[model samples]
Target chain A: MKKTINIPLGSQHIALLEPVRFSFTCENETIVGVEADVGYVHRGVELACTTTFKFKQVGYVVARVCGLCAIIHSTCYTLAAEELMGQEVPRRASYLRLIANELDRIHSHMLCLAHTAENAGFEALFMRTMKDRELVMEAQEAMTGNRVQFDYVSIGGVNRDITTDIEALIRQRLGLLKEKVGEIKELFENNWSLSLKYKGVGIITAENAYRNSALGPLARASGIDFDVRNESAYLPYGELGFASVTMSEGDIHARNMVRLLEVFESIRLIESALDGLPEGEIAAKVRGTPEGESYMRVEAPRGECFYYLKASKGQYLDRVRIKTPTFGSVPAMIEALKGANYADAPAIIASFDPCLSCTAR
Target chain B: MFKALLNALKNLFSAPATLNYPFVSSPKHQGARGLILFDEPKCVWCLKCEEVCPPGAIRFTQDRESYAYTYHYNPYLCIYCAECVRACPDKAQALSQCSELSRPTSDPFMNDAWFALEKEAEDSKEAVKELKKAKKTEETPQP
Candidate 1:
C-alpha cells in the first residue's frame, strides 16, 4: 500500500518573525518533497523608492526593509548611487562605513546564533550569547549614535567621523569582545546536545551550494571560498587582510561554526581599519544627475545584497531594483528541505537564517 | 554508564556563568541611546529636530501669538534612531536615558502619550500666563 503524509508549516511559526509557509510531503518520518510560498510581508519598498522618494531619501527607506541587515541595504544603495554619480568617497568615510558595517554584521550574526540556540531548546546558551552580543550594540551606539537604522551614511559620504576617543574606545571594547567570543565558542563546541541537534542535519554539499549560488556563510560553510568583500574589494575591506572562512561539512553545525568564526574575522577587520585610520574629509561634494544604470553588491550578514539603480536628470530615481540575499538562497533552502526528516524542518529552515522581510521587500 | 553519570555530576556543581538581567542591571554607558524625553521650557521652536528626523515621528507647529512650540511624537513610528535627539538645537530638548518603551494599547501609534501630555502642559502654562497678564492690565487703568 502507498500512503501519503502531509505536514504543513505556516508563515506564523514561533521560530519565524516574518511569514513563510512550507508544505512537506513525507513518508513516515522522512520528508519526500517540500514546497514554500512567500510574499507575505512585501511592503513594496523598492516600488516606493522609485516613485515616491528622491534618490537620497531612498537609502533610509531601503534600510528599513530589514531591521537586522539595515546597514548592508544602505551601504549597497549608497555604493550604487556613488557609482552612478561617478564619485569616490573619501578614505575616512569609507573606513567609517566599513566600521559600521562590521559592527552590524557582528550584532546580526550574534542574534541569529542566539535565535538558533533558543529554537534548539538551549536557553542557557541563548541567554549567554545574547549577553555577549550587547557589546556590539554598545559599540554601535558609541560610533553611529544608534544601534539599529544608523542614519550615518549619506549620498556623498558618511554623516559623521570617527574621533580619536571613539577609535580608542572601539579598540578597548573589541579586545574584550574577542576574549568573550572565544569563551562562547569553546562552550558551543563542547555542548553535546547542540552537536547532536545540528550535526548531519540540513546537509548541503559545497558543489550544490555553488550550483545554487549560495552567498555569505551558507556558501562558505560548504567550503566555497567566495565573499564579495574579497572579490569586489569595496571600501576598507580592500585594505584589510580579511580572508573568507570556509568548511566542508555544509550541515547546520558547519554553518553555525562559520558564522561564529566570521564574527572573529569581523573584529580583526575593524581593528586593521582603525589602525590605518586616515585623516581626511569624511564626505565629498556630490552634484549632477546620474545618467545611466549602476549595479553594486555588498556582503551582508546573510549573503550578497545587490542593488541596481537608474537615475535621470530629476531628483527622483527612474528605477530602483534590490536583490536581497535571502531571495537568492530561498531556492537552495527548498532543495535542502527535501528528503529531510519532518522533525528537522525548522532547523533546516533556520539554517539559512531566512529573513522573509528582506526577501519580500 | 557509570562514567557518564560521574561526569554529569561533576558538571552540575560548576559555577553558573549567566547574569540575572532583571535582578542585576548591567552597567550602561553614558552615550547609550535609551528612551527619548522632551523638556518643554527650553525648546526654542526652531523645528530643526523635525527636519532631521529620519523617521517622521516628530511634528511641530508654531503657536500664533505666544511664539511657543507645539510638538507631537508618534512613539509607534519612532525607531529610537536618536536622529531627532541629535538634531535638537537645544541640548535640553533631546532624548533621555529611560527606555521603558511599552504601551497598553494595541496600536503602536498612540504610544507617545507621555510626550503629548508634556507638550500640552507647557501650552497650558503659557495660556495661563497670558490670562494672568490680561487680568492685571484690566485691573489697572488703561494707559
Candidate 2:
C-alpha cells in the first residue's frame, strides 16, 4: 500500500519572481503528478491593447508586457506595423535594433543563471553572476537610453542612435563580460555540488518537448533545432552569423549549458553587427494607416514571442493578440515536474526560467 | 577543492564587489533615461504629448473662460519611454539621465502663458462686430 499527500508550492514563494501556484501530489518524497495555475498576474493586457491604444502607440504600449524583453516586444510590433504600412527601415536602424536585442538577451540570460544558482543555495555564485551582469546592463543603458525598458524601437525606426563613444564602451564591457562568463561556465560544468543538484534532474525528452511544443532554450536543450532567429527575417540575425546552440540531455544541467553557450553566440553576433554597422538614415517617412492583418515573431531571450495585429485605415487597431513564449511552455513545464523529488522542485522551476508576467500579460 | 580555496584567496585580497548605495551611487552608463524636464515657455498647448503618451502619464487641460492651458505629469504612471519628448514639435519636454523621480505632496506641473493670446483674439472679434454694427446703422439712414 502506498500513501500519497498533496503539497502546494506557490501562489507566493520566496524563490518565485512573480505569482504562480503549483500543487504537487507526492508519494513519499517523489512527485507523482503536478498541476500549475498561471493566471495570478493577468491584467488584461491583450484587451487593453485593442481597446485603448492606437496603432502608432501600440509599440510602446506592448513594451509594458515584459520588462526583461521590452525591446523585443516593441521591435516585433514595429515590424508588423511597418509591413502593413509598406515602409522601409534603413540598414543602420536595423543594425541598432539587432544590437539592442542581443544586449537584452545577454542580461536576461545572466539573470536567469543567477536565479538558478540562488535556488541551488550557492550564494556566492548568485552574487558573482549578478555583478558580472551589470556590465551588460551598462552597455544596454548607454545605447538604449534606459536600462530595462528602453523604448529603443519605434514604428519607422529606432528612437536613439549609438554614438562612437557608446560603441567603444560596449566593446570594452563585452570583452570583460566574456572573460567572466568563461569562469562562471567552468564552475557550472565542474562544481560538484551544482552537478549533484542540477544533473539528471527534471528531464524533458525530445519527444516530450515536441509533443508539448516547447520553445527557446528548453527545446534546444532537448535536441530540437528550432529558433525564431533562424526562421524569421524580423531582424538581420543571419547576416551577423547567427548560430543556434543545441544539446541532447534535456535535463536541468543541459538547459543551463544551452543558455551558457548561447551567451557566447550572442556576443559574437553583437560584435559582428557593430563591425558591419551601415551608414544611412535612422528613420523612414511613414505615411497612411495600417490596413489588414499582419503577424510578427521575434526571438526573445526565453523563446519565440509572436504578435498579431489587425487594423483598418483608422488611427486605432481592431485587435492585438500577443502569444508569449512562457504561455506555450507551461504544459512542458508540468510534464518535467512530474516524477521529480519534492526537494528538487524549486530547482526544476527555476531551470525553466518562466516569466509569469509575460505569460499572463 | 584546490580551486575553491584559490578562488577564496583571490576574493579576500580584492576590493568588495558591492556598492554602497545612497552613499555612493552605482556608475550609470551613458544615455540613461532618468527624470523628465518640462520647459513651459516653449510649449504651445498643442496637447501632442498627451496624445502620444502610452500610459496617459501626461495630461493637458484648458480653462475655457480664461483660455489658459495647464499641464500635469504623474511621475508614478510614467514608463520613461521618452515618447512624449519625441512627439513635441517645439521640444518643450526632455529627459534628464541624472535627475531622480521623487514623490511630491502636491503636483509640480502647471502652466498658463497663453491667456494673453486668447484675450487678444477675443477683443479683435468684438471690434469686428462693432464695426459691422456701425456700418449697418449708417446704411439704414441712407436707405
**How many clashes in candidate 2?**
0
> Per-prediction TM-score, chain A only?
0.97, 0.98
For DockQ, the strongest prediction is: 2
Residue A92 of model 1 has an lDDT of 87
Which ten residues in a row are the worst by lDDT in model 2 chain B? B95-104
List DockQ, one per candidate, in order. 0.17, 0.52
lDDT of candidate 1 over A1-361, digit per residue (tens): 6687888898788866459998889999998888888889989998898886667667888998999999889999998998888887888888899999999999999888887887777776677778888888878877876778787787788876777788888888888889888877775677788888898888888878888888888898889988899889777676787788999999988889999999999999999988888899988877776769899989999999999988876778898999989889877788778778888887677778888899899
Q: Please give the range of 10 consecutive residues that has the lowest summed lDDT in model 1 chain B.
A: B96-105
The superposed Cα distance between candidate 1 and the true structure at residue A112, in angstroms, equals 1.8
Which docking band does candidate 2 fall into? medium
Q: What TM-score would every model get versus the actual structure? A: 0.79, 0.89
DockQ of 1: 0.17
lDDT at position A62, candidate 2: 86
